[model samples]
Structure formats: C-alpha cells, structure tokens
Target: MKKSLETQTQLVSLNETLINELSSLKQVIDESNKKMADKMDITANALITSNGSLAESLTKAIANELNSQNRKMFGQMQKIENLTVESMSKLSSRVASDQTLSKVAGNQQVLAKRMDGLATQNQEILKQMEIS
Candidate 1:
C-alpha cells in the first residue's frame, strides 16, 4: 500500500506538470496571435497611406496636363483669330481700291466725250474759213 500510494503521488505530480506546460503554451500562442494582429494592422495602415498618396499624385498630374493642353489650345485659338482679322482687313482695303478705280474710269469717259465734241466744232469752223 505504501508503494502504491507513492506511485499515485508521482502520477499526480506528473499530470500537474503537464497541465502547467499546456497553460504556458496557450499563453505563448495568445501573445503570438496578438503580435501578428498588430503587424497586420500596421501593414494595412501603410498600404492605405501609400494608396492615398498615389491617388493624389495621379490627380495632380492629370490636372497639370489638362492645364498645359488648355494653354496651348488658347494660344492656337488666338493665332487663328488674329489671322482672320488680318485677312479681313486686307480684303476690305482691296474692295475700297476697286471702288476708287471704278470712279476714276467713269471720270475718264466723261472727259473723252467732251474732247470729241470740241474736235467736231473745230472741224466745222475750218470748213467755213476755207470757203471764205
């Protein structure tokens, strides 16, 4: 009986040691899980911040490109407008000169008619003087 009691006590002590080891393992697993969760959170936050910065950079680049294109387009439009105005001015000047030329031609026709009339009168006068 004494030997049996001693064996039983030894078995009980072995079971207690096993229970303590299991508890210690459980605590270590919990701490590892917590550390993994913290790392994941930190990684998620970093990804979010990086994505936000990338989006901002893309937006600014697009806006700058649009502004540059707009400026170029505006300059082209102004050049076209200036060309149109210059062509119109030249056409107006040509039209005025054409009108002036027409007026001068009409005056020349009137002067020719008067000269022809005077030549006819001089011929008649010369015929009368020859007969006298």
Candidate 2:
C-alpha cells in the first residue's frame, strides 16, 4: 500500500509539470500572435497611405492634362473663327463685284439694241437713194 501511495504521488507531480509546460506554451503562442497582428496592421496602414498618395498624384496629372488640352482647343477654336471671318469678308467682296458685273451686262444689252436700230435706218436710206 505504501508503494501504491508513492506511485500515485509521482503521477500527480508529473501531471502538474505537464500542466505548467502547457501553460507556458500557450503564453508564448499568444505573444507571437499579438506581434504578428501588430505587424499586419502596420503594413495595412502603410499600403493605404501609399494608395492615397498615388491616387492624389494621378488625379493631379489628369487635371493638368485636361487643362493643357483645353488651352490647345481654345487656341484652335480662335484660329478657326479668324479663318471664318476672313472667308466671309472675301465672299462679301465677290458678291459686290458680281453685282457690278450684272449692272454692266445690262448696260451692254441696251447699247446693242441702239446700234441695231441705227443700222436698220441707214440701210433704208441707202435703198431709197438707189431707187432714185
């Protein structure tokens, strides 16, 4: 019976040692998990900051490009407007000249009719003299 009691006490001590070792392992695992969580959080924050900066830079670049394009478009529009005005001025001059040419043609037709009448009268006079 004494031997049985000594064996029981040894078993109890062995169980206690195992429980302490398990507790220490659990504490080490918890500490490692916490450190890993902290590192992940810090990495996530850095990535977010970098993404924000990249987005801001892209937006500024796009705005700048749009502004440059708008300025170029405005300059082209002004050039087109100037060309249109010049073309209109030239067309107005051509129209004025056409009006003058129409008036001259009308006058030429009148002069031709007068010359025909004079020729007919001269021909009739010549015929009368020849008959006499």
Candidate 3:
C-alpha cells in the first residue's frame, strides 16, 4: 500500500510539470499572435493612407518630364560629338607639324657632318704649310 501511494504521488508531480509547460507554450503562442496582428494593422493603415489613384493629370505630368529629360540628353550628346570633331582636327594638324619638324632635324644633322669634314681638311693644310 505504501508503494502504491508513492507511485500516485510521482504521477501527480509529472502532471503538474506538463501543465506548467503547456501554460508556458500558450504564452509564447499568444505573443506571436499579437506581433502578427500589429504588423497586419500597420499594413492596413498604409494601404488606406495611400489610396489616391495615379489619375490622368499625374500620368501626363510624368510623360512631360520624361520628354524634357530626353531633349536635354540629346542636346548633350550633340555637344559631345561637336567637341570630338574639333579635337580630332587639332590632333591631325599637330601630327602634320611633327612630321615637318622631324625632316628639319634630319637636315641639320647632315649640315653638321659637312662642317666637321671642312674643318678637318683646313687643319691638315695648316700642318703641311708649317712643315714646308
């Protein structure tokens, strides 16, 4: 009879533990449900606040803005093209001048060699005169 009573006491303790765990689980579920409800309420309020339709005048205004932007971009593209053309012309002129300068430098080198040869011939003549 004492063993039977001890078994009963253990069963009661286990039942109480399960009940406490269930209560804790219920509290966690309730908090989750409250958070979901708050999020849904915020979504609903945002939907209600921004209910104004994108009507005809607003669409026309957006179209006008897009057109204005397109015109400005096209004008900028034309300016870039003009600048490229002008720069290319200047580069061509500079290249031509560089070629002419290179030719002039070659002629100067040839003239220097000729002057050195003449000076060497004059020195040989002077040495011969001094010996005679």
Best by TM-score: 1
What is candidate 1's lDDT per residue for 1-132, written digit by digit as tens?
A: 999999999999999999999999999999999999999999999999999999999999999999999999999999999999999999999899899899999998998898899888889999989999
* Residue lDDT tens for model 3, 21-132: 9999999999999999999999888876655443555788899999999999999999999999999998988898899889889988898898899889889999999999
**Error in Å for residue 126 of model 2:** 12
For model 1 the TM-score comes to 0.72
Relative to the unseen true structure, what is the C-alpha lDDT of residue 26 in candidate 3, on a scale of 0 to 100?
A: 95
Please provide TM-scores, in order, for all candidate models, with all chains considered together. 0.72, 0.69, 0.43
Cα RMSD (angstroms) for every candidate in the order listed: 3.4, 3.8, 17.2
Identify the runs in model 1 with alpha carbons over 4 angstroms from their true place: 1-22, 128-132
Off by over 4 Å in 2: 107-132
lDDT of 3 at 105: 90
Off by over 4 Å in 3: 1-63, 124-132
